[model samples]
Target: MERVAQTGSTNADLLARLAGGEHVGEGHWLVADRQTAGRGRLGRGWNDGQGNFMGSTVVHLTAGDPSPATLALVAGVALAKAVTAMAPGLDARLKWPNDLLVDGAKCAGILMERTGNAVVIGIGVNLVAAPELPDRPTAALAAKGAVLDRDRFAEALAIAMVDILWTWRQEGVDSIVRAWLPQGHPVGTPLRVSEQGIDGSFDGLAPDGALRLRRADGEVMLIHAGDVELRRPVEGN
Candidate 1:
């Protein structure tokens, strides 16, 4: 673990280091107290307030391991576990693809980038405060009465990620899927997926980690990529 007062983006910095032939071995982490150009999936800006958890880890794919894409599930499960452990009795759910939700609001997000045999997984969690997001609700651990510092949270997250990634390499994607499902919303929860222009109930996750969307016409669509939003239940349904 390497801690810095600030950085442009942990993922970008680590990628630059890798490009320059730096040996960022697996389980190595880079954490920043502040990020000026942090990013999320689909080119969205990730806001990182001071004292929040802004860190990245290096993962090297081994033989017989799943695709690099499946790292998203690995990250989500590790984050969910870490946060729940920090804030006991809180409902920490894994939003499909790679977001952590607390009480239906996003509290953290994961971003993964691949370079050759290495994958840099960046994670940002709102520990001290939540930024104002225009499209969706957001929350912070402090707001939920959990008093944890960035270093403490980062330490826990790093340990959880290391343990889970080992499982992914040893047991395969089925083991990860089994562990993630219980931390996520139940099957059949209504969802609105923006990428495919489909609004359907959550079917489940496919064997390869693609999202399963059960449409109204009884068609089960396997979506490889998309933005997922939990739908509000209709009154008196």
Candidate 2:
């Protein structure tokens, strides 16, 4: 584990280190107190304020393990568990692909990048503060009454991730899906998937990590990539 006062991005820093021939073995983590150029999925910039949690982990995949894509779900499950453990009585749920939600607001996000046989999983959580997002609502652990510090939360997250990664490596995607299902929105929840430009009801996650979307026409679409939003009902419907 390594903690820095500030950096452009933990993921970027680690990637650069790996490119520079730095040996970042599995379970090694890099955390930043603040990030000037942090990023989320789809090239969106992440806000890494002083009180937030910004970190990345190095994972080297071995043969016979599930695809790297499944790491998002693995990270999500671990994060939900860590946050809930830190803030007892707080209900932390996961949004598909990789986002953590409290109530209905986003409190954390996960991003994974692969280099050779190694992958860096970047996670950012709103510990003491949540940033203002343009399209979605955001919340912080403190605002939700958790009041955890960045270092403490980072520590908890790292531990949780280590355990979950072990499960994923030993078992398979089935185990990961089983662990994730309970922490995610229930099957049949209404959703609007932005990338596919489709609105559908949430079916469930496929064993291999694909999101199963049940469309209005009775077609079940397996979406591999998309931004998901809980569909709001019509006022009078």
Candidate 3:
């Protein structure tokens, strides 16, 4: 694997270069010490400083392709595995879609961009503790005792991701779901999920991957996709 490490924004620059006809292929990555215009899920902005693991990998898919959701899961799973391997005693878990959490704190987040038959996976992990966001309960890796070497971690992640991707491709979604279950957060407990317009509330993670929450009128609603904020049980809170 090869890496292009720079001092500035990686995601923005990669997209720019890619638009300019630079054909980046698999096994190559565009890494940045700081992403001035870093992005996150749900169109949130990230203010990544130096001393963080912020980068993106370019993965090329075959011309005829399936949905890219599996790749996203594989990337998250591979990253969780690598982080656990790098830091023993780190009980890393996967928050569905693409977040790696250790001891209930976020250690990594992945963003995938698809163009035609290729996908560029952008991963941002905080090696050092990040500043607090009053609006959410998100977290960083250093808060979970995971301070890693960027280059080494990136290499391990890429290789492991390739393996995970291969397995998911061969065995299909069931295999991926089975592997994801053990690491999943406990079910039947209230999970704080984003409400359509107002603040979200506690619910449980459904078996088929939707977030199950009771509405104001005692109706149970299944959320397809949105950010989730795992909260402590009312007694615990």
How many backbone clashes does every candidate have? 0, 0, 2
Per-residue lDDT of model 3, residues 150-223, tens digit only: 77877777787777777666776556666666665655434565544423343544444454666566677777
lDDT of 2 by residue, 1-237 (tens): 899998999999889888888899877889988999999999999987788899999888888888989999999999998988888788788989899988889999999998888899999999888889888999988898888977878888889998999999899899999999999988998999987679999899998989999999999999888888888789983
Candidate 1 regions exceeding 4 Å error are 233-237
Per-residue error (Å), model 2, residue 23: 0.8
Tens digit of per-residue lDDT, candidate 1, span 1-237: 999998899999999999899999888899999999999989999986998999999998777788889999999999999998888878889989899988998999999999888899999999888888888899988898888877888889999998999999888898999999999988998899876667898888999888898999999988888898888778894
* Candidate 1 structure, TM-score to reference: 0.96
TM-scores for every predicted model: 0.96, 0.96, 0.80
- Candidate 2 clashing pairs, residues 3+ apart or interchain: none
Which of 1 and 3 is the better model by lDDT?
1
How much lDDT does each candidate structure score? Answer: 0.90, 0.90, 0.67
